[model samples]
Target: MIYLQLFLSYLQIGAFSFGGGYAAMPLIQAQVVEKYHWLSMTEFSDLVTIAEMTPGPIAINSATFVGTQVAGLSGALIATLGCILPSCIIVTLLAKIYIQYRNVKIMQDILGTLRPVVVSMIAVAGLGILSSVFFLSGKFAPALSNFNIRGIIFFAGALLCLRKTKLSPILIMVGCGILELLYQTIF
Candidate 1:
């Protein structure tokens, strides 16, 4: 029964999570955190971090993580299968249709329209993570007292590095971790 539930939940995530992993964050959060209570918001945030740092898509990694937590290795396999199945089917079909209609106005228009929606979804996911990192309460509502100054400073510095330097993201992440560890040790 638990396996069935995991499969179905991930199936829904895979089916509707358009525009890739970043866009799927909200749906994954809804199922894993809000619906199943498998993980807390902080855990979900950590999961997102882990997922991003590792290989493969965020949805698949999240499904595997949640499934493993819920039901171990077998659960991870089932959840991963469920998460990829819809994408497999949809992409195959879409590929065929796109190859046939690559130049059609309607197809172009549809793709154009989807861009903003995907961007908005990604932005929402980013903001959610930012709120979780920056605020004590982890809610959208802001409070000056709850602000995490170190986190904001690190974020700003990272943003600046990305915008102004040639440093790799992985290097930036490593640097931030090292800085945080040193700060914790010294302060």
Candidate 2:
């Protein structure tokens, strides 16, 4: 019964999570944290952090982690299969359809419109994480008093580096991880 629930839940998440993994954050959070209660918000946040730092899609990482937590190795396999199945089928169909309609103006227009929607969804997910981490203690609204100064600094610095330097993102991530480790150890 639990395995069936996990499969169905992740199948829904995988099928409907358009706009990639970042945009899928809200859906995954709702299903995993709110609907199922498999993990708390803090734990979800931590999972997201780990997922971001690791390779592969955030949704897959989340399914594997959550499934492992819920029912170990077999659970992980079932959840991962569930998470991948929808995308596999959908993409296969879309690829054939897209190839057939590659020259259509309406198809081009639809894809163009989808680009901005995907960006918006990703932005909203980013803001949600920011609010949850930085303003969570404030309860009602985000307050300067509850701001995470270190996080802001890291974000600013990373953005600047991304714009001004030729350094690869992996290098920047490693540097940030080292800085965060030192910060945590020292302060």
Candidate 3:
């Protein structure tokens, strides 16, 4: 039953997550965090981080991680297969259709319309993570008392490094991890 649930849940994610890995974050959160209670919000945030650092798509990595957490190796296989099956099917069909309608104005317009929707999905995912990191309650609502100063400082520093220097994101992540470790040790 658990394996079936994992398969169906990821199947939904794979079918509906249209834009890319980042755009799929909200759908993944909806399934694993909000609906199933398989992972807490903090775990989801960490999953996002780990998924980003890994080589594959975030959605696939998330499916594997959550499956492993929930069941075991076989669960990981089922969840990953479910997550990718839609892409395999859809891309095959869409490729033929796209080749046929590549220059159609309606097709171009539809693609243009989807761009903003994808951007909004990515923004929501980013804000969700930021809220989880920077707020004590891990919610969108803000309270001065519940704000995390260290998280904000790290965020600012990371933003500054990204904008002002050519430092790679992996280096920034490592720097933040080291800084957090030092902060934990010192204070």
Candidate 4:
């Protein structure tokens, strides 16, 4: 029964999540954290972080992690399948329609409109992550006293690297990970 619920929940996420992994963050957060209470917001944020660092789509990674945490190996498999099932079906269907109407203005228009929405979704996901990491309350509304200085420093450094240097994102992440490890050890 829990497996079925997980499947259905991810199926809905996969179906509605149009612009890929980052776009699905809010939906995943809503379902897993807010709706189901399977994970706290902090846990969900940590899951997202782990998912991002792993070698697969964020949605699938998140499903696997959350499912495993909740119901073990079988749950991981079921949740992953559920998360990807809708994407597989939708892509197949879209491919057929897209091939036939590759030149259609309406289709192009739809895609154009989705670009901004996708950007917005990604932005929301970014803010969610920031809130989780920087706010001691692990929520959007952070009191001044609750601000995480280390997190802020990390964020600023990452942004600086992104803006001023052409360093690979992987390198930046690895660097940050090492720095964080050192910080944890020393302080």
Candidate lDDT (C-alpha), each: 0.92, 0.86, 0.94, 0.90
Put down candidate 2 lDDT per residue, 58-144, tens digits, no spaces: 999988998899989889889988999999999999999999999999999999998998898888778767766665451335567
Q: Which ten residues in a row have the lowest lDDT in candidate 4?
A: 135-144
Runs in model 1 lying further than 4 Å from the true structure: none
**Residue 169, candidate 2: how far off, in angstroms?**
2.1
Best by lDDT: 3
Per lDDT, what order, best first? 3, 1, 4, 2
Model 4 Cα lDDT, one tens digit per residue, 44-139:
878987998889999999999988988999999999999999889999999999999989999999999999999999899888888878877876
Inter-residue clash pairs, candidate 4: none
- TM-scores of all models? 0.93, 0.86, 0.97, 0.93
Estimate the Cα RMSD of every predicted model relative to the unseen true structure: 1.4, 2.2, 1.0, 1.4
Cα displacement (angstroms), candidate 2, residue 141, comes to: 2.7
- Segments of candidate 3 deviating more than 4 angstroms: 140-142
lDDT of 1 by residue, 101-128 (tens): 9999999999999999989988988998
Best-performing candidate as measured by TM-score: 3
Candidate number that wins on lDDT, 1 or 2: 1
Query: In candidate 2, what residue range of length 10 has the lowest lDDT sum?
Result: 133-142
TM-score of 1: 0.93
